[model samples]
Target: MRRPSLNDLAAFAAVANHRSFRRAADVMGVSRSALSHAIIGLEGKLGVRLFNRTTRSLSLTQAGATLLARLDPVLQDLDRALDTLSEERGTPSGTLRINANKSGARILLANVVPRFLDLYPDVELDLVSEGRLVDIVEQGFDAGVRLLEAVPQDMVAVKFGGDVRFLAVAAPSYLEGIVPPTTPDDLQAYRCIRQRLPSGKRYRWEFAKRGAEIAVDVPGNLTLDDNDLLVQAAADGRGIAYVPEPFAEPLLKTGQLVTILDDWCPPMPGLALYFPRSRHVASPLRAFIDLLKRWDGAR
Candidate 1:
């Protein structure tokens, strides 16, 4: 077996990533025809089709996905190493990618990121909102938000946002004539609006009563992925919503909603900023970590 050159790998990665020969060539500062020829030459050498190209769109073949899955990390490490070398001369200025849930990002905006951007205006934040667990390192994210329990054992988890608790609430009008459940068991009788997870599963409402924590896959009339929509549905008397306390607390206080199942919810882990501790931190990640730490202290 022969080893591929840097040019071959770079060409392959760029083409696979952009999924467009023209875009890859533009980014690589080469003519489209030249880039195509290089890719053709590399493919002949490797003897595998890396891409499934059509007149309008390009898609990665199975072989291409496999190679890309392996190479993306290697390229990121190289980029990070290059950045570290550059850091010897001055402050870091580059993109820092993160994947977080919607509520987590709201907390960051409310309490963390403003100060971070104020401290370093040149640094860029490419934040993605996603609820499902993602392979941050493989997905090219520098870091991600996760619950303390959800965070991997090896990653360093910094508490950026304080603990989260679930709230079960319903509108005062909705509760009219209907006696609010005095106990967790009574919740089984009520219609609920629930969060539907990415896996097409309705989120079970979790509660704590006395010393026991119970997870109930309660029945719901309306199920959706959007947390805000769930809240709206609850407000419209569609059903009770089991949502993060941060969102429902304000409404509960205002009497727009009444809280139930308080004893069932123990404070769960807060929004955690975590990344692999073993890998060398890029300057952007280091600065972001510092920002989170500082923000945590102030909170």
Candidate 2:
């Protein structure tokens, strides 16, 4: 028997969490064989088989599951402690991981990220753009960016972007044979492009006017999970799309798309940055939030 190294434990945790040697290896930036060897060595030291493997799938053994349940939190705590120490040493430094949807990422790319990096060279930014609403604390993210309504009520929220409006738009070719929609209900008669959310439900187009809000589940032949793809479909004459103004701007300018039911659409709370209120904020993360507030004020 021998002492298990921290590297071996980390490798084991990654593999256990992902249940795929290939995926874990990719995350660790190491070869599959190297990760396998590390895990094998770790198992030998512990004198227990950590995983059951078949060609199609991998599952953790009881010992492995117990180890993972305990190890993950310890590693997370260790990482947080180290980050805290880094903050105390003069300037803010260490990785600041953010989880954001595509639109939120777009806002950060356009305004905050580049400038923040220049302002705090010691901070490392890890931005993950996805279509899911992640639990920032559970996922070990410094913060997450999401639409205002999507943010959890338990978290601290900050405005990150300007108020945004959804526009029902279509290419001229798609609208040629059809009467334009003058109201939200009129959308039901048109071939609308719809968005499929990460929660496995279709996103009903939302519109508001004069203290009234309307959600329309317009029928369409196409539905997609990606916002960019939905906008592209509209530009290509597939169908009319209900999308944020920013995504449809270029096409509007180029005359590839024309808006309908503009009077029905009103601005909603835009993208917001949020984090668990109970957690201690890292210096880099705090500084980033301050920067966002300053930018919000400036705009």
Number of the predicted model whose TM-score against the real structure is largest: 1
Per-candidate count of clashing residue pairs (backbone under 3 Å): 3, 0
TM-score of each: 0.78, 0.77
lDDT of 2 at 4: 99
Error of 2 at 249 (Å): 3.1
Q: RMSD per prediction, one decimal?
A: 5.0, 3.7
Across residues 66-101, which tens digit of lDDT does each residue of candidate 2 receive? Answer: 999899888878777877787677678877889998
Candidate 1 deviates by what RMSD?
5.0
* lDDT by residue (tens digit), candidate 1, 1-299: 35678888898898887777876786567999998888877777788988888898888889889999998789879987888775785776777888888888888777778887877677888888888987675465778887778787888788767778878888988889988887667878998786889877777777776667677777776788887887777877887888888777667777788877667667877778889886668888888888778768876
lDDT of 1 at 253: 77
> What C-alpha lDDT do the candidate models reach, one value each?
0.80, 0.87
Alpha carbon deviation, residue 279, candidate 1 (Å): 3.0
Q: Candidate 2 clashing pairs? A: none
